[model samples]
Target: MLNNMLVKKAFRIIRRNYGCPGLDGVSIKDIKQNYNYYINKIIDLYNSYTFGRYPVKTTTITDYNNKPRDIFIYCLYDRWIQQILKLQIEEIIENDLKEYVFGYRRKLNIGMLRKYTKSFNSKYILNIDILGFYNHINRDHLNKVLIKNTSISKEFLTRIDLSFSHLSNGLPQGNVLSPILSNYYLAGIDSMFNSKYARFSDDMFFAINDLEEQNDIINKLVPELGKLSLSINFEKVRLFETNSFK
Candidate 1:
């Protein structure tokens, strides 16, 4: 699925989004100036079966909560490769993701999420946010998940791993591939709950018909997530006994 045509498509994606300059300070305009050379360079790297790490640029900004959030940016070629990988990997796994796993996907949105939550109409809504989800991704288990899917090419999987070789753990927060990869990794949560929940990225939530099941759920999740080297951010976890989904 990844080819020269797909590489060109990735370029189109980067340009359409007006991708930001990374730590190297190379912009889309810079690439457009000598577009063919850069395009061939990307092709050459792939043709040689090599994927190299680029310095990630990070800037801290105040999120909506007024808390500092670090946004990561990769070099131009790196972004292109990531976009290419995203497009291919999405084809392999997108349709297979759980119905309530709403995050970073083109087809699902907040309206559908609200409707799903409303359909529950349970007595309690438990909101559980994984702490620094992107930062804490278990690469080994993630690799396992991707590897188990026999349809994905080994070369493709190798390139994806090389893209993140610099990080001992965690996926880069700003990379194009991170969102979908995170979704794939956390699909275990949906399986754990038998899809009785709504998750927007790592913002995990569950609607409970009985308050008694609340503690049981949390207690079970604690150890289950640990199997993947993950832990709940207790500070961000909360339980609401509500009459309605709102």
Candidate 2:
């Protein structure tokens, strides 16, 4: 059943888009063996540039010999982020381990878009517009604040309770860190898999060289997120081996 879902062009497009200098020699079977080294190097590069002040884009360039440097630095930062993603794909190819899968529950689902984009043969395809969605929710939160502030204190208390009741189901208030933490985990999966090959919304795929490593990731993630009320549906979890193993 899953075999029919495979879009052969997805791999071709990924190779075309992210196939870079260091990616030249990697293969699908050796990804895991090389992932840690690549990720460490990426972390080193990010830490080096991201220290002191966050990279920003504006008409400010008093640093680096007084030449306009902020925009160039910002672009460079983005380039490194992209290169790190490419290396992750190479890592996936080099490793031969059991495949891991995850099922996600979220307010929105983009399963159809995932299907459609895969069918379209695009180089970089992501169904959900995560950035746009975040902006929309933040605007809504701002509106709620305006409504609360414009009202009388007694009525404001009642409206605040009602507003928060609705907001919790959307994105929890006073939790800007929640979004960062969620993105961190999501990004970590991409780093782990070294591929946009990981599915969104309903599923995630992890291919590791060792079965034990796969279990280790699950153990780490489950406890890390346990206090946050994040959950997993174990019934949907399945184990499969490539036909090459048999």
Candidate 3:
């Protein structure tokens, strides 16, 4: 599925969006210097169906809380490859997900989220964030969800599976493929909460009948999320009156 034409387009998209070189500090211009070479390398990696152990630059940044957070960076070619994979799978996964899942989906935004949540017409709205979402997703569960929900080729699946060899958990935050995989895994939450639910990435919103039902959902979410090795960020959790949202 990693072909020359698609890879070339992926390269152009990367160049247009790029701000800096990655991992090895290799710029998109540097990649264009021997574009075919990088393309060949990515295509061969696909044929081999093995994780290339591609390099990612690691750096720390201060988050809103003034705490340090480490983010991963991938080289231009790796980003190209990831973009191709994302192009292949995101639509399929997005279609499988509910309309309320607003994150990383095309043609979706806070406006759409608001419209959908309002449709529930319930008495309250609960907003809760998952703790360390991108960094805490279990790799094994991610693999399972991706395979179950996507129809990618065996070779493509192997390339993803092989990637798990480098790390035991978490989707690296920077790559395009990370969103596709992460969104699909969180589909469990979408399924578990059938209606009156909206999720924009890790932030989940639920429309509730009252306090009793809200507590019951929260109580249930703890263990269900625990099954995925994830937990709620209680400090950030908020319950709002329906009109407050309106």
- TM-scores for all candidates: the values are 0.90, 0.26, 0.85
- Judge candidate 3 at residue 146 and give its lDDT: 66
TM-score of 2: 0.26
Q: Which pairs clash in model 1?
A: none
Ranking by lDDT: 1, 3, 2
lDDT of 1 by residue, 45-88 (tens): 76666655668878777853355677787888788888888888
lDDT of each: 0.78, 0.34, 0.75
Per-residue CA lDDT of model 3 for 1-246, tens digit only, reads 456887777777777877556765667776778877888877886566644366767787785335466766776656766777777676777678887788777788877887788778888789888999888998877767666653765566776655444456787766667777888888887898887889887889998888898788889999989988999999988888777784
The best candidate in terms of lDDT: 1
Instruction: Name the 10 consecutive residues with the lowest summed lDDT in model 2.
Output: 1-10
TM-score order, best first, reads: 1, 3, 2
Greater TM-score among 1 and 3 belongs to 1
Q: In terms of TM-score, how similar is model 1 to the real structure?
A: 0.90
lDDT of 2 at 163: 23
lDDT of 2 by residue, 1-246 (tens): 111112223233333543222312444334346644544543553434331122332343452113222212122223334333333332332232212212122232344324433443433322111222222233243334334433223332232233223233333312212232233234333445443244442244333445575576567556533433344446455443422211
Residue 134, model 1: Cα distance from true site in angstroms: 1.8
